[model samples]
Target: MNYFELDTPALLIDKEIMMDNLHSMQNYANQYNVQLRPHTKTHKMPKLARLQEELGSAGITVAKVGEAEVMANNGLKNIFIANEIVGKSKVERIRKLAETIDISFGIDNTYQVNQIEEVFEGAEKRAQVLVEIEVGEQRSGIIEENDFRTLLEAVKACKNVEFIGVFSHDGHSYKAQNIDECKELYLESVNRTLHFAKLAEEMGLKPKVVSIGSTPPFMLNFEIPNGVTEIRPGTYIFMDSSQANVIGTYDRCAATVLTTIISKPTKERVITDVGAKGITAQTRSIGHTATKGLGRIKEFDDVHIHGVFDEHAIIYNESFSNQVTIGDKVRIIPNHICPVCNLYEKAYLISEGEVVEEIAVDCRAKLQ
Candidate 1:
């Protein structure tokens, strides 16, 4: 059956293109001798996470404890929640997960260390954790050397918590002016993360995994420094409009929103069935990853969604409106694939225009 026959506003993944993306990133990791622990927050589907593990991802990286549990329940044992695990309830959940699988989380302060120490009081194994270094992203990471040492000291003094290694997210690379600036910023961020790893070594806590990632830096194929042990690129599996801008091509973009043209409101105005609730209203607004409009019209060249309402995507392309009728379907390559994925309940896996599988968004609302 034709994909246009499926309900309006469905997510679709091109199987061949998606597989190529998965293999390409894994090959990059293998070439650099680093583990590709892909961030599963991209798709949030256990099936895709398992496929990544089979395709050579060392483990899986998730954003929340709920996602970790979903992946772990699906038999993805080696898991890393790449965000600070706060509160007694979340800490206790980690304690429960630790009992059966190899699980670890991010920490930037001793307060988190102390909390984990209390939660894993009589657990079978010590709570494993990694300290996050603020490597220019200006996010939730320890920026100062003294702060890094202080957090490590707390981990060292802890009776149950075990410091695994240092990690950092160079998200700033997404806004780099060009590929050259992207490479320069990437190296600096890697060096800063490596510096923290060295500090961990000096403090007698030999880090087992020194991880650093953000898709933009890796997409450029900039050389991964020696000290880094793993790369956790999330959106590489399903290239989006923003990432395609960094590379100057959408050939690798496998995910798209399959929507039907609901109405031709005016001579130059077209509306699709999907909107802010579907493709989202996010724009890169900066450097190499900067995108045009809300979403790129996948079937038409130089066409984009002018805007989106709660349930309608506004299009101002007279040429595009002339090309399709009111019921004709079109695909929109989103600016950011991560959040766009969370909105759909399932994705139609297409192979040469035929729906082969229905991949559920298993962790759709696993925000906790």
Candidate 2:
């Protein structure tokens, strides 16, 4: 079926563009001699995650245990939950998932280590975990060397836990002013993460995986150092408006919200069927990742969504209003593809204007 015939506010993935994105990231990882563990959080689709593995991805990364369960149920063996997991219930869920797959999660403190040790006790396999170093995002991670040492000491006491490696996210790299700044921040984060990895080594713990992530650095093709074993970029799999701005083009963006014009209220005001409920009200307001307005109207030149109601996107442009009538379908390049993906139940895969397949957003509401 032709994609144009689809209903309004439908999520669309250009199959060609999406495949190119997956291959490009895989190629970059290959060239740098690092394993590509593309984060499935961007698409939240088991089908896309499996495709990444088929295209030479070493494994898949997720933001939650529920997402990991969804992926594992669909046959993804190796999974990493890239967030500091807390709670006995969550740990139990991970333990059950561990029974079937090579699963792991992040830890920034000894308290988590103790919890993991308690949960995985007497189980057949040890709980695999990675220490998260706070590299500049100012988010959840161990910041001090002494604290990291203490955490490692706690891990040493855990008979059921295995310290596999350390990981860091250079999320602040998204705020880089230009290419030079982006590269500088990216390298600094990598170096800081490596510093902690080295500390773990000095204490007799050998880290098998030194993972670093953030889409800007990889999108700009920054060099990965020798010690870094893996890259866990999530947004690269489904490039959006903000990521496109980082590289100065939308040619790499594969996802869009397909909406139809529902009204022409005024000569300069047009309304789309989708609003914040569909494309979302997300925007990249600073640095190289900054994008214009709520979302970009792909069919118009420099025209953005002026505002959005709960169920309508407003476009206030005389030229845009004059160019189209009601019932005209258009595409919107969302600012943050992660949450935008979660807003939909299914995404239509299109190639050359034809709907090739319908992919379910398997982990759409798996937020726990």
Candidate 3:
């Protein structure tokens, strides 16, 4: 069936463009000599996750234990919960999952280390963990070298927790003023992570994997430091308007929401059937030059979605009045692709404007 036959406000993925984005990211990882573990939280589809692994991803990265469980249940063997996993419930879940596959997670504090040790004690296997280092993102991580060393020491003391190495997000790279600044931030993050990894080795801990990446930094072609062993880049698989604007191109974005015009309230105003529920309410930061609206209409050049209601999108372009009419279908490039994927149950794989496949968002609402 054709894509138009599907209901409005449906998620549509351009198969060709998505394949290019995936291969391009894999090639970038190869150039840096780091294993690519594309984060699955972005797409949340097992098919895409497996495709990424088939295209040379060493493994898959997830933000939540529940997401890791979903992937594991779907036959993904190697999984890394990149975010810090705390709480007895989550720890126990991870311990149980370890029975079937290799499970690992991130830790930045001694509290987490102690908790993991207590939960996984006497299990047949130990949980591999990566120490999260805050290079510049200033997010959740061990920023100070002393604190990092302390966390490493705590992990070493844990009989059931195995130290894998260090990892970082470098999320601040998104705020880079230019491509050069993005490159600088990426390099700084890699260097700082490497410093901590070397520090771990000095303390008699073998830091095997040094991972780092974010969409902006990963797109800049920065050299991954010699000690960095893996890269976790999620958004590169389905570039959004925000990523494209930052990187100065839109050729890589493969996912979009297909909406149809349902209202023409005025000569200069139009409304599409998609709104916050369909495209997400996320907007690009003010620093981005292309920041204008919630999304852009792919079919109408220069047409932007001015605002979004619960179930309606407002488009206020006078030119749109001349080109678009009621019932006309338009593709919307979402402001942020990650949450948009979570908001949908499935995505229609479109090739040449036809629905080629309907892929389930198997990991959707797996919020644990």
Candidate 4:
């Protein structure tokens, strides 16, 4: 079916561009001699996860147990929960999944280690875990080297837990003022991660897997220090306006939200069917090229979505109003693609500006 025939505010993915993005990331990982474990939280589609693994990714990384379960049910045997897996229910679920697949998760505290130990006790398999070190994001990760060492000791005591290695998400790279700053942050994070890995090895806990994740930093040709095993980058698969701005190119972005002009409230105001609920209100906040709206009109480069109600996106450019009329369909490049994908139930795979097929966003809202 043609994309124009679909309902308003539909999610559209350019198939050729998407494949190029995927292959480009895989090639980058290959050149660096690092395993590319593309995080599936961006697309949340098991079909795409399978495609990634087939394209030479070592495994897939997910944010939640529900997403992991979805991919596992669809035959993805190697999965990693990039985020720290807490709660007894979720720990039990991960332990069960470890029985069939090589499942690993992040641990930043002794409480989580104890919970995992309790869940996997007497089990035939142990849950492989990576100690998360906080490099700069100030998010959930072990900050002090001594704290990490203590956590590792406790993990070694757990019979059902296997120490995999160390991991860190250099998410602060998104806030970089320039490419040089991004590179600096990436290198700093990697250095800290390597330091922790060395400490673990010195304590007789040799880590086989040293992972680092962040799309912005990974895109740069930052040197991957020796012993860094895997790199998890999710947004590289289908970049949006934000990532494009970071890399200074929109040519590689493969995702867009297809919307239609529904109303011309005023000469300077045009409303589309998509709004915060569909395209999201996320905006870029770094440097002089910060995006001004929820999304940018792809066909009209100067037009920007100034505001969004629950059901409509308001475009305030008079030039756009003169160019577009009611019922005219337009494609918008969302500021962020990950959340946009989660907001939609399905996405159209477009090739050569034509809709080739529609794929379900099967893992949408699987936040449990």
TM-score per candidate, chains pooled:
0.99, 0.99, 0.97, 0.98
Query: For residues 68-170, could you state the per-residue lDDT of candidate 1 as single tens digits?
Result: 9888898999999999999999999999999999999999988888889998998899999999888888889998899998888888888899999989999
Where does model 4 exceed 4 Å of error?
none
Worst 10 residues of 3 by lDDT: 283-292
List, residue by residue over 1-368, the lDDT tens digit for candidate 4. Answer: 77888888899999998999889889989988999999999999888999999999999999999999989999999998988988999988887898889899999999998998898888898889999999999899999888988999898888888898999999888888888888888899999999999999999998899999989876666778888899999998888888888878888888899899999988999999998899888898775236768888888876889989888999998988998889999999898889899998888899887888878888999998
* Model 3 spans with C-alpha error above 4 angstroms: 288-290
**CA lDDT for candidate 2:** 0.93
Please tell me which model should have the higher TM-score, number 1 or number 4.
1
lDDT head-to-head 1 vs 4, winner: 1
User: Which residue pairs show backbone clashes in model 4?
Assistant: none
Number of clashes in model 4?
A: 0
RMSD to native, candidate 2: 0.7
Clashing residue pairs in candidate 3 (N, C-alpha, C atoms within 3 angstroms):
none
Ranking by lDDT: 2, 1, 4, 3
